[model samples]
Target chain A: MKIHQLSVFLENKPGCLSAPCRALAEAGINIHTLSLADTKQFGILRLIVRDWQQAKTVLESHGNVVNVAEVLAIEVEDKPGGMASVLEGIERAGLNIEYMYAFTIRRGDRAILVFRFEDAEKAAQALSKAGINVIDSVALYDLVEKG
Target chain B: MKTEHCDVPFNNVSAPDFLAVAKLRELQLQRLQCIVDRAYNHVMHYRDAMEQLEVRPEDIRSLDDVRRLPFTDKTALRDNYPFGLFASPMNEVVRVHASSGTTGKPIVVAYTQADVDVWSSVMMRSFAACGVHAGDIVQNAYGYGLFTGGLGAHYGAEALGATVIPISGGNTERQIMVLRDFGVTVICCTPSYFLHIAEKAAEMGMPLQDLPLRAGVFGAEPWTENMRRRIQELTGVRAFDIYGLSEIVGPGVGIECDQQNGLHIFEDHFLMEIVNPDTGDPLPDGEEGELVLTTLSKMAMPMLRYRTHDITAIKTDPCPCGRTVRRIDRISRRSDDMLIIRGVNVFPSQIETALLAVEGTLPHYQIIVDRQQGLDGIEVQVEVTAELFSDTVKELEALKSRISHAIDSTIGLRVAVSLVQPRTITRSEGKAKRVIDRRTN
Candidate 1:
């Protein structure tokens, strides 16, 4: 199972982050999780929102260059070794994780870990075979909406 | 053939080219008086400037009296704009050419039929000086449109009875193919552009030295002796420097004889003077100063004591080629703030305009000019605002691209845009230092 993530290009400037966040909020699109990757000049804001299309539309209307990327979102136990166990399975399956971020669902005891892998489809199959509970876009949107 | 054997007096050398010192001075004095009288009678700008100096046309008796004339700079040209400076009426003006003005309005120059003939003859003399003959196939690579370089060289090559390919600048692969296929003998363009062609030829597995090209009449921008040697060594072409300005006459004011010593100023057509740039006082021979030119033969627009701002000394010593017209050393530097990047004149102010148009960029920026692979490279390092300093990599990259595109569209030159950290650029208290040029030889 794969999850759709919104990757936005942002100049490393003040109010650049808030502009998109405000736009998405005004559009009534809820962001489930966001992680920022930055260099001195610019940064990439990766986000998982409840409505990807609406979030992209609102951001694009604000003159932002937005793109969609497929990632693996899996549910893991909110325990110390939970992330380590999933990463070890990914490593064993020869899949490399580009970056990852996590957020806990208020309704469940488990944590939602979003991972961007070099090959998302291959990682999804390997994680599924490894007995990891991979959440698809529908389930991920539902979880985000429930919160 | 080797350059040493080809080094000889051009067949088109006129009587003025062989005038003795006394005769040359006498001719200059007579021509100076005629032009001064013409400018005073025709052009109001020159008349007012002369009247302000209280110097009448009759006052210019000797060549030394040229100092009494008011100095005309680029400001005068800008003030005159389109055709205000022309001495002749519109019907007499046969052609018009202009400098690429990235900062403001382009400097416009007009040529009458007589003026066109004079330009062609002078170009022919320049080509002949470089050992180009009637049978030689001249592949002109200088830009043709508004700039005087392309058509100027083309007319001259044709006047010399040489077969001109008339191929304008750029298109490196095609330039090489034409060079090989046509067996082009003489190449004409800026020294830097020629070097680029040589590099491209080498990349295409056809080094220029093996080509049939024999001579190159290179000008439009200042170049070095080392660059000449490198061009000759790589392309096996004897490179000669041809000097001219659109203000006086484009691409035919002076040319280097086969001696490759100094560019011989065409004393009969244009009166050349060396003057102190600051004081406007004349400097003697062998003393370096700003070059002032008065168009003696130009009919459309006769520029009187027009300051060239090119720093070089005149050589009175006789050249081995026997051309008695005095030679000015090859120009390597300019007294003005203009920077010639890839044959296009760029001012620091032009770069500022380009930067201010883009968002998220601070006013603080530095233009760095360097020579890489014998071609000019410009890098605009702009400071990002504190807010934008933390933007995503993709956003910053987009900003950089936008800036680069703006500058390219504005100036017609490609530049690498670098987004530096906020407050990283040094603040200057006095004059804001905008340019860092390391392309000097």
Candidate 2:
């Protein structure tokens, strides 16, 4: 019902964003989805990777502050209103969504939407009740590997 | 001849203020002998130190023999704790003051009524040196507590027959209001805090230059001359540096005259010396080294050759302002590991103490000191457990703020707290380098 997301702290320099990506790529860790939250001085690079532990180790070895957070990864329809429907269900459940990013699954005509919520467990239950497919860590890793 | 555009040529034209070099040395010798005798007969710590040197009080026959005395440092005060260094008994003691003791126990000093009078007179001289006169309104913004800045300036203003507003630090809006309503003419605070006040005034759409403030007596921390220029440019006030420590006396140890060149040490009250910090050898005038002071007039706690750790040189040339007392250059750096952040003396161990007291924080931390926009900024980066790292962003932010607040309470200086992942801080082999002072660069 939850997925592991890797967050790395980066100073707002020219090559900060690429540095982490290169580190992950060199470590053979595939990034499933990413969303960047930034301010004037620094930025937080949030990545949902197939091998999050390896991604964290690689980033930390590069002197970056890395944290692993549990988030919900849900598979939604690839149509235009797919993300909107999932957000509507989350809004109705009173579970706030901090941020979300999406990536397409290789085989199915669906997209994987990674969500950070105030309460991950509550968000997962609310999405499940709304008949949405909540993918666990193992299933999400498998899909990313397949891609 | 008086210098043009100067407020006053000299604050006091008394005999000692304009004493000839030979006569001043004679007076210093007499006073030095008196304090040595007082300390030897009264304070046991001084007696033990002197005994260890096998030197008698009467051995200080000449000014050069004064070096035969033992040197006192901060550790002496710590070992004695509250009032072990007082030459006068507690029953006769009139007041007590202390350092923040952020790293450990606070160093306490007591003063008798006569010593308090001496402190006030020196403070008055300090204000007058900056051209602050009687009938002026003084706003004393130094924090009043165990810290000595507030009451030290407060009594000096009162003794100078100036109206004093005892508005301590903080409450920025109220400070501005008083600057306007009370028509403050002189402000006493740290140079950094004064700039902060000026910034706040600008934020409130008020021009600090338009206020009646004319002079600012800033001390209790080291500030650069460029900062002084910025302060003068912003507030249209003459910023003068006042130097002192609780171990010596409070805020009136030395002050810059209208010359604005260097601070004039009140030679009549304090005997000043500059010695090599590493070797303890006395350096000649114009040579920068650690400052050593001896109380010539203090009755209760007469510090004898106390190593101040503040690094500066003395200027022996006579000033055009007609004062014979030598002036010390602005303090640039300390020989020790003390950091003056936002005008508060901070040590890395103090931050470590605060961080260790708070839960969820590891022992590893680094102190980063930088000068941002002509003011000192401190950031404490602490490594926390991975469990705390796995917490939600909101919780992590709360924890960071909590650590910051805890450190603020401990050191009385605001600092940015960064909670990093465990094992992120670099480990040291020999002596751990806890401070990164980027301000010097």
Q: Pick the candidate with the highest DockQ.
A: 2
Give DockQ: model 2: 0.17
Which runs in model 2 stand beyond 4 Å of their true positions?
A: A1-7, A11-14, A35-46, A51-57, A64-103, A106-147, B1-15, B19-27, B102-104, B171-177, B196-212, B227-236, B356-366, B370-375, B382-388, B419-441
Residues A51-117 of candidate 2 have per-residue lDDT tens digits of: 6777778888876777777889888778899778877877887888777777656438788787888
Candidate 1: residue B364 lDDT (0-100): 73
Interface RMSD, in order shown: 8.0, 4.1
Give candidate 2's TM-score. 0.82
TM-score of 1: 0.76
Worst 10 residues of 1 chain B by lDDT: B1-10
C-alpha TM-scores of all predictions: 0.76, 0.82
